[model samples]
Target: MAETALHNTTTSWSSDFKEITKMRLAISVVFSSVAGYFLGATVLDFVDVLLLAIGGYLMVGASNAYNQVIEKDLDALMDRTKNRPLPAKRMSVQMALFIATAFAISGVAVLYYINPKTAMFGALSILLYVLVYTPLKTKTPLAVFVGAFPGAIPFMLGWVAATNEFGIEPGTLFMIQFFWQFPHFWAIGWWLFDDYKKGGFAMLPTGKRDTKTAIQVILYTFWTVLISLVPAFGMTGRLYLTPIAAVIIGLLGVFMMYYAIMLYKKRTPKSAKQLMFASVSYITLLQIIYVLDKFIR
Candidate 1:
């Protein structure tokens, strides 16, 4: 009986750990970092790649765990987050803090083995996400804008990890993801406006989903598409996309824009949901295309 109880306890703890860290979200962010790694790596050190993945996941997980700890009370007020580890009382606050601290320190130390710049950015990502973005969520709509900086770091972080350099190449990657986030997050905010309001979190540009907000989404989506094609024009040194890849990226942008326009026309939650999915698909497909193009050409 004691053995069975131990097994159950272990299983529960594992599940709670995954929940607190947001494993899927952490992995998706790690994927973006790996994509950047593939682009900037000249020699393809498999060991470094492995380290990058581990460090990326740890840092992202730490940030998420910290967010949960800070937002436990607020999270309980929203349906989507009410059942998370902290809000659901699956884990104690002290335990969550321990996990977050362990992950953050380990992640930064591992990244430092890769390079100082990589580790610096990793630390910065945690600090900004937890200290800046989490607190600002209830204060102003500008939270999303402030959040975009740390959110955009993974793309360039992989490049820095692989190259130990920061320049136009990584800058281009940063810009592309930075602009992409506005449309993506705004769509989510549009659909979940009511849920977010329950927590007093103002995530939308206008604090309400209206024509004005939709118009802003459209503008940012357009800019995201435009910046994505800049490498094809030789504007970004050391990061040249073939004209064919450029055309492909342009088409993807157009698809994202179409949904944004649809949201603007309808101004409904359903349309916002569609735009949100499209924005996700757009970024995933864009990263695949960029990485594949780098290898194929």
Candidate 2:
């Protein structure tokens, strides 16, 4: 009977690993890593691509796992996150800890096989997101700024992976993503203001979602558009943006700004939701344009 119980426990633990890590979300993060890889990879080979995706997924998967482990208690308080495996007790703390460490260590090892620099960056991203940003979320609004470092690195990590060095091309990808996070996150903050408050997360600039916060969102949105165009102006290193691609990317940003302005003016939940969706569409579309522009040019 003891052996039977032990076997059942091991099977249950395996199931919990799948749920606790939130593989779908981690895969989305991995996809962004791939997009970054594409933007920077001058020479594409199947082997390199496979290594990048696997390492990227493992790296991000580890970060997400660590996030849940640390925030398990807080997760129970947030409606949007309360159902996560950790908070729901679907996984024991020790089990989750082991999973997080395994993924993180293995991820770095995989990246190391790509190149030492890329591996370093991958490890740094995991450290920053988990060690720095995760804890800071409950402490201050500046967490967004700190978090952007890791968030932006994926775009450039690909560049470094391909080029084996950091240069203007990867820098441009990093800049656009860095600026983009502000508005993207603020919009979510606006929409989820109540939930964040309930969870004791200080996501918004002012903690209160109102005119002050809205104006900051607008400011960041403007910055995002402006920085995105720097590549087109042909001043940001070798990453030159053709006039046509610049105009198209600009127009997309304008569409996003229009929604942002609307949300600012109305400050309604629905409008915030619209802005959030627009932000998502904006970044994804922008990434598509960046990759597509390479072919067009």
Candidate 3:
């Protein structure tokens, strides 16, 4: 009976750790990093892929842990985040802080061993996300813009890790992901606007889920589509996106834009939720298209 009880407690503890890490979101971020590495690397060996996964996870996990620590009280006030490890007391603040610091140090150290530029980029991402973006959210809506700066780094981090240098390809990778964040977060803000309000977070540009916010989503959506096609124009060097791939990726962007328009026109929570999900699908599919296009062409 004691062993059984211990097993249950251990499972619960593991679950809380996963929750603190925001595993799903971190995995996607890491995936984009791996994709970027695959694109920029001449070989894309197993070791590079393993390192990207480890480094990306620790970096993002550390950010999530620190974010939860900083927002513990605010998180308790929100329906979506109230049961989080920090807020619910599943993990003490000291424990979370220790874990966050350890993860961050390990993440940066690993990347430094891989390459200095990649390590510096990882350090920058953690500092920006935890130090800048976390505190800035409640202070100003402009935080989203600043937050995107670090949020957009992972996709390019992979490339720099492989090449050990910065180049136009990584820059282009960064640009596509950078522009994609506005509409993505705006849709999330629309759906969770009330929850954000409860926490005093001005996540939306207008601080309201109305026409103005929807228009901003559409504008960003347009930019995302346009910039995604730029690689097809022969400007991306050996990274040509090809005519068919560009057309298909362009159509996918159109689908995302259509949902944005629907949200703007309808101006309802349901429409916003739909757009939010669509944006996830759009970016994930867009990334897949990009990776596949490399093989196809």
Candidate 4:
């Protein structure tokens, strides 16, 4: 009985850790950074790439864990967040803080070993997410605007990690992801507007999923699609995309924009949800396309 109880406790603890850290989101963030690394790497350093992945995941996970700690009370008020480790009481605040500190320190240390610039950006991303974005969520709708800075860092961080320099290539990558976040996040904000209101989170630009919000989503989606094709113009230094690859990406962007347009026209939760998924697909597939384009052509 004692051994069985111990095993059960261990399993529960693992589950709570995943919940508190949002491991899936952390991994996805790491994926973006890895894709950036591959695109920017002149010579493939597989070992360093692995280190970046570990460090990126740890830093992102730490940010997520810390966010949960700060928003424990607010999280309890929303259906989507109520079952998180902190709100569900599966993990104590002290434990969460300890985990956050461990991840943050170790992640930064590993990244510093890779390059100081990489480490600096990693630390900055965490600081901005925890200090700036978290607190601003309930304060104003502009929080999304503020949050986009750190949110877009991973795409550029990979380039910095590989090249240990900031240039047009990384800047272009940053701009692409920077513009992409608006429609992506706003679609989620549109669908979850009511749930966010329950927690007093003014996530949407207009604080409601109405015509204005939908129009903003459509406009941003257009901008995002346009910026995504910028590298194909051979203006972004090391980040050139062949015209064939450009056409493929353009088609994908149009597909994404089509969903965004549907959301604008219908302005329903269902449409918002479709746009949200479409946005995710757009970014993920876009990253893959960029990487493949680099090697194939």
Candidate 5:
């Protein structure tokens, strides 16, 4: 009986860790970073790629853990966040902080082993997410704007990891992800407007599910689409895309924009949800296209 009880306790802790770290989201972020690494790397090193993946995941996990700790009370107020480890009382704040600190230190150390610049960016992402964006969430609608800085870092971070330099190539990668977050997050905000209000979080640009917010989503989607094509024009240094790849990316952008427009016209929760899914697909496919073009072309 004691052994079984201990086993259950262990399993519970494992689940708590996963919830605090938001494992799936962290993995997705790691995917973007790996894709960026591939884009910037002319010579592939499997060891470096593995290190990048581990370090990137750890850093993202650390950021998420700290965010949960900071927002524990607010998280309990929202339906979407209420089941998280902190809000659910499955883990103590002290334990979460310990995990976060360990992950942050280990992630930065691993990244530093790769290169100093990579570690710097990883540390910066954590700081921005925790210190800046987390606090701003309850204060101003511009929290989304501040959050984008850290959200967009992983993609470019991978490029810096591979190239050990920050240039137009990584800058272009950063810009693409940076602009893409507006539409993606606004779609989430539109659908969850009620839930966010419960937490006193200012997520949407206009802090409401209105035409203005939808219009901003559309505008950002347009800009994201345009910036994505800059590489094809040979303006973004080593990040140039071929004509065919550019056409494909443009179509994907249009596909996402179509959902954005539908959200604007319909002004419904379902439309907002659809836009959110499309935006995710758009960004994931865009990264894939960039990496494939680099290798295949």
Candidate 6:
């Protein structure tokens, strides 16, 4: 009976760890960094790539854990986040903080082994997310703008890890992801407006779902589509996209924009959710297209 109880406890703790760290979200963030690494690497080193993935995941996990710690009360108020480890009372704040601190230290150390710049950016991402963006979430709608800086870092962080330098290529990569977030997050904000209101989060640009917010989404989607095509014009140095790939990417952007337009026309939570999904698909496919075009073309 004691052995069985021990096994159950172990399983529960494992599940709590996954929830606290937001494992799937951390993995997706790691994917962006790895894709950037592949794009920047002239010759691939699997070891470095592995380290990048591990370090990147650890850093993102740490950021998420810290975020939950800070927002424990607010998280408990939201339907979407109420069941998270801290908010659900499955884990104590001290335990979460310990895990976050360990992950942050280990993540930075691993990244430093790659290069100082990569480590610097990783540390900066955590600071910006926790110190700046997290606090601003309830204060102003511009929090999304602030959050974009950290959110966009992973893609360019991968490039920096590979090249150990900052240049137009990584800058272009950063810009693409930076602009992409406005639309992506706004869709989520729109869809979950009520849930966010419960937590007093100023997520939507206008702080409510309306014409102005929809217009901003359309405008940002347009800019994201335009910026994504910039590399195809041979302006971003090593990050140039081919003509065919540009066409495909352009089409994908248009596909996402179509959903954005639908959200504007329909102005419903259902449409907002569709736009959110489209944005995710767009970004993932865009990364795959960029990586494939580099290798194949």
Indicate the residue-level lDDT of 151 in model 2.
90
Model 6 off-target regions past 4 Å?
Answer: 1-4
Question: How would you encode candidate 5's per-residue C-alpha lDDT over 34-72 as one tens digit per residue?
Answer: 999999998988898999999999999999999999999
When 2 and 5 are scored with TM-score, the better candidate is 5
Worst 10 residues of 3 by lDDT: 234-243
Worst 10 residues of 2 by lDDT: 24-33
Candidate 1 global lDDT: 0.94
- Counting clashing residue pairs in each candidate, in order, gives 0, 1, 0, 0, 0, 0
Q: For each candidate, what TM-score against the reference?
A: 0.97, 0.92, 0.98, 0.98, 0.98, 0.98
lDDT per residue for candidate 1 within 1-297, as digits (tens), equals 999999999999998999999998899899999999988988899899999999999999999999999999999999999988888898899999999999999999999999999999999999999999999999999999999999999988999999999999999999999999999999999999999999999999999888899999999999999999998998887777999999999999999999999999999999999999999899889888988998999
Error of 4 at 77 (Å): 0.5
Clashing pairs in 5: none
lDDT of 3: 0.91
The residue-by-residue lDDT of candidate 2 on 1-297, one tens digit each, is 999999999987766666677777567666666777777767786688788888888888788888989999999999998877788887778878888899889989988988899999999999999999999999999999999899988878877877788877888888888988988888888888889888888988888778998898899999999988888877866566788888988999999999889988999878888998898888888877887887678
Cα RMSD, model 1 = 1.2
Give the winner by lDDT.
6
| Candidate 6, 214-289: lDDT as tens digits | 9999999999999999999988999989999999999999999999999999999999999999999999999999
lDDT of 3 by residue, 95-185 (tens): 9999899999999988888899999999999999999999999999999999999999998999899899888888998999999999999
| Model 2 C-alpha RMSD to native | 3.2
Query: Candidate 6's error at 123, in angstroms?
Result: 0.4
lDDT of each: 0.94, 0.85, 0.91, 0.93, 0.94, 0.96
- The per-prediction CA RMSD against the true structure, in angstroms, equals 1.2, 3.2, 0.9, 0.9, 1.0, 0.9
Candidate 3 residues lying further than 4 Å off, grouped into runs, are none
